[model samples]
Target: MGKIPKNRDEALWTLAEWNLSKPEWQHFYSPQLKSDMMIRIAKEWKLDGVMLHYNRGCEGLSLGIAENRLAIAKAGIPVMTFEGNMGDEREFDEARTMDRIDAFMETMGLKRELLHA
Candidate 1:
């Protein structure tokens, strides 16, 4: 109780670090960390591209996705995003998603080869 913020800014900053509740702080923290993580994972895996799903159903997880995509692309990683809903099929467009995925692959100079399992 004694370890409390003196004012609103301090309080919100603390909360932002903990839960990312403040919008402005979120803008700063989310993009940087998310981008760094994506970049790290891409490097570690020697990935050719990254795919991001903008889930319309979960606003919190979707936050700063556009910024993340931009950052990942800036780091010389091919990145693409498709908007969809995890819990609701109505918000998902399968054809569009597939087309976008194909485009992404094309941009990476990849050609699909069908394999028989």
Candidate 2:
């Protein structure tokens, strides 16, 4: 869901069909396609890092996330993953997610800052 299409073909398929490689991941998002897209976008935008939300009920989408994180880290930016479920409030863990987020920010040398001073 985070990757930006690199070309017209990708844009069309990614947006319209989700371009996912297999059927295990979510019905909408393609884990394989998204992994590739994220790697590219992180490089293109010079991003500081990436975050992966592995839904508890969506094993299909979360299956290859570890590999995705590895490939993304190869680009020299940190990648963080946390647990949660889509549309299921009971599966969400606020404290754990927050901890991972904090760790990611610390790894990236980021700190809370005022948007407008």
Candidate 3:
């Protein structure tokens, strides 16, 4: 893993390692602003899908599951939520996760071939 930067400038420099250019820099810097920007990018790139992780541990930072689902659906893409605790094995229930994913795929009419690998 790369070292976490101590400040914003150092963080931007570190992002350069991932080939992110200065013109594209603003997107990485501000996440609250990034959602709308990403919706625009999705349309511009002709993307067929979007996913939002309604993470358990990071619930404070994440848009709540209902709103996230609504936003993605409004963008005309299928959205699914998987509940998993970051870095906590005890909180990650694989069976429940798979069930939610399966139900979501079924409701969205996603083919088993497309979803199951």
Candidate 4:
């Protein structure tokens, strides 16, 4: 505050003062913030499904990923959570990832239409 408020009712705050007026500085801390943002983005862009990534090494980000996936799926769209590590080659498995992706697509009513003879 520029100065102490003269009275309890004199408090005034602006988004700029809270450092939330900038795109990079703004974030929603609400319980459903992440889920809401994802749903909104998908709806706004007319997305069919959501593929969420889960990095094994990042505990903080990986935490509650299952809950997040459930919330996203509750938005009436298919959601997929793929497990992998950013820089760990051992965690990267093409066959498993592709299989999961294929299964997710099938659950979303999508089929692999291309066939090689």
Q: Estimate each model's TM-score.
A: 0.71, 0.64, 0.53, 0.67
Model 2 pairs whose backbones collide: 24-60, 25-60, 25-61
Count of backbone collisions within predicted model 2: 3
Q: Report RMSD for candidate 4.
A: 6.4
User: lDDT by residue for model 4 over 36-103, one digit each (tens)?
Assistant: 66777889999989998888876656555666688788889788888898768699788998888888
The parts of candidate 1 lying over 4 Å away from their true place are 1-29, 113-117
lDDT of each: 0.81, 0.72, 0.63, 0.69
Residue pair clashes in candidate 4: none
Report the lDDT tens digits of candidate 3 across residue range 4-115. 8999998887877555423254344544244555566678987666655656676454544455456557778766666677757688888987787777777767766788
Compared with the true structure, what per-residue lDDT tens digits does model 1 show for residues 1-117?
A: 236899999888787566753444454566787677678889999999999999999887788899889999999999899999988989999999988988888777776552111
The candidate with the higher lDDT, 2 or 3, is 2
Q: Score candidate 4 by lDDT.
A: 0.69
Task: Please provide, for model 2 over 38-61, each residue's C-alpha lDDT reduced to its tens digit, 9 standing for 90 to 100.
Answer: 787788988878888877787766
Q: Which one wins on lDDT?
A: 1
Q: What is the lDDT of residue 60 in candidate 4?
A: 56
Between 1 and 3, whose TM-score is larger?
1
